[model samples]
Target: MLIKKIKRRIYNLFHPIQGELWCLHRVLNEKSVFDENKDLEISPDYLETKIKHYKANNFDFISIDDVYSKRLSEFRYCWQKKFINITFDDGFEDIYNNAYPILKKYNIPFTIYLSTDFVDRKPLIWWLVLERIVLTKENVVLSSGVIYTCPDIISKRSVFKQLCDLIYNEPDNPADTFRRLFSNYVSYFEEKTANTLTWEQILEMCDSGFCTIGSHTVTHPVLTRQQENEVRREIEESKRIIEKKLQQEVLHFSYPYSFWNEQVQDIVLESGYKTAAMGYGGSCRYNKDNVYKLPRVYLVEEST
Candidate 1:
């Protein structure tokens, strides 16, 4: 903790502004890892405890609306006091099923960034595919014309990182690389295996007035891999779909994979969003510049 504080102080020296801090996903139920016996769990009780700590520490719990509100009256209270905003990503069903109740109990507002593809029941995320194939299968053939065979257990992590580096760190068309990776592994999983929030659940949350919806993109493509036209379509099409369904304008976005460059930022602005969240870690202050590329802290179970 002391090291982290020192790091934050060092960062502040260079960056000056404390960007937004957020918790990505707060699951209410116990979820299974590859090994069912080693389940991942996050209970309401645990979250409540964390919230108590946040409040005691004087951190502001903010939502998407709070970030982009033209009227700063409510925010002024936090801004003057130095509170942290809370946000969730990937529009997980648990956000509706579990997290919402806790937020309401505390009257805390939050923003949920949705990936339209998953909301529409697209296949699993690419990383999940890598996990399944690498852990469950002995050999895998990808549509990208690459073949992968699992290494010894001792070397699995390094091997997986190597594969990711080859695909994601390439100078070639990043979109094509991701597409190839997806086509290769997505075929292995059934639709039911993919976790996603239903449209009804989203509407329910909207009506509850405890949460607001924003875009993560239609297909959750890495923006840096795509051309300007493709990037524009991803942003504009996602906002259009969410707006039509919710009967409310969608003005915020979270980039898929948290990958963005200046070109992608231009596309996001052109898409008419008032603000966008990045996976990069930081805090948000009212007077900070670049509202479009707002940084958010990711809360993982390990960290908690």
Candidate 2:
């Protein structure tokens, strides 16, 4: 905890502009509820209060599209300006019903990155799989050589972060380790709670003139895990689906989970995307930057 505080302080000192604050799962009316058996209960009302605070303070809330467009240029034109871009990951229906109106009212431009598979109701996401075990099982053991029990579930966020860190920092076959862990533990959520965006819903949002849709790959795989051929297929296929559905060229891609390596970066450029967003926390700079591997800030409820 002390290390994290120090890191944040250091980041604030060097990158003081607050260039972009990317947000995920911003639901407006729903309230957070704890469930012994479920991984998460979202609170839309709680999110709204944060949004209100940001607005009241006059923070510049930017969308992913804005980052690729105006904000990118702004960083070049004036590097010292305080700017913050808001981006939503995974196409959630609540983003349309709950977050959109608020953004519209505030006139905040944003980007929504979609995992094409979930749009079609594909099975569980890998991270959610870990979440299932953490949330539902009494005592779970991971193939990654980690053990977590239900009592530990009270610290769900911290547990998840630790699991992710283990996978990321593993010296040998991290990809395989993560895949084994996910495959061994994930189960589907209750049908009613399944959240995904439908084709018609996506079209409506595109037509609403409020959002810019970007590719999050078809299956939401960790790019660093897949073979080069597989990674290329994921990026290319997702662009094709998004363009065909929305009739707009899908130029931007957000790395699934914002995790990637050199090979992944090569695949993104080779697959023909203009810009690819990573989940890394940083501000954008002009001229001396790589367009394909752009960094983004992750916004939490507390940060707002």
Highest TM-score among the candidates is held by which one?
A: 1
TM-score of 1: 0.78
Encode model 2's per-residue lDDT on 35-106: one tens digit a residue: 311222235565566668767776676666666576565433333455666677778777877777777777
Cα RMSD to the true fold for all candidates: 5.1, 6.0
Which pairs of residues collide in candidate 1? 18-283, 19-282, 19-283, 19-284, 20-283, 20-284, 60-83, 60-84, 62-85
Provide the overall lDDT of each model, using Cα atoms, as 2-decimal numbers: 0.68, 0.67
Candidate 1 residues 1-304, lDDT tens each? 9999999876555444433557565466564343211122356676677778888877666666765663222334333455456677676677777777887888777788888877847555555556556666566566756667665654555556666677678665544575566575555555354467889988887887877888988877787877778888889998999999999999888887788788898888888888887887566544554677786766544433
Model 1 weakest lDDT span, ten residues long: 32-41
Give TM-scores for every candidate, taking all chains together and pairing residue i with residue i.
0.78, 0.73
Assess candidate 2 and give its lDDT. Answer: 0.67
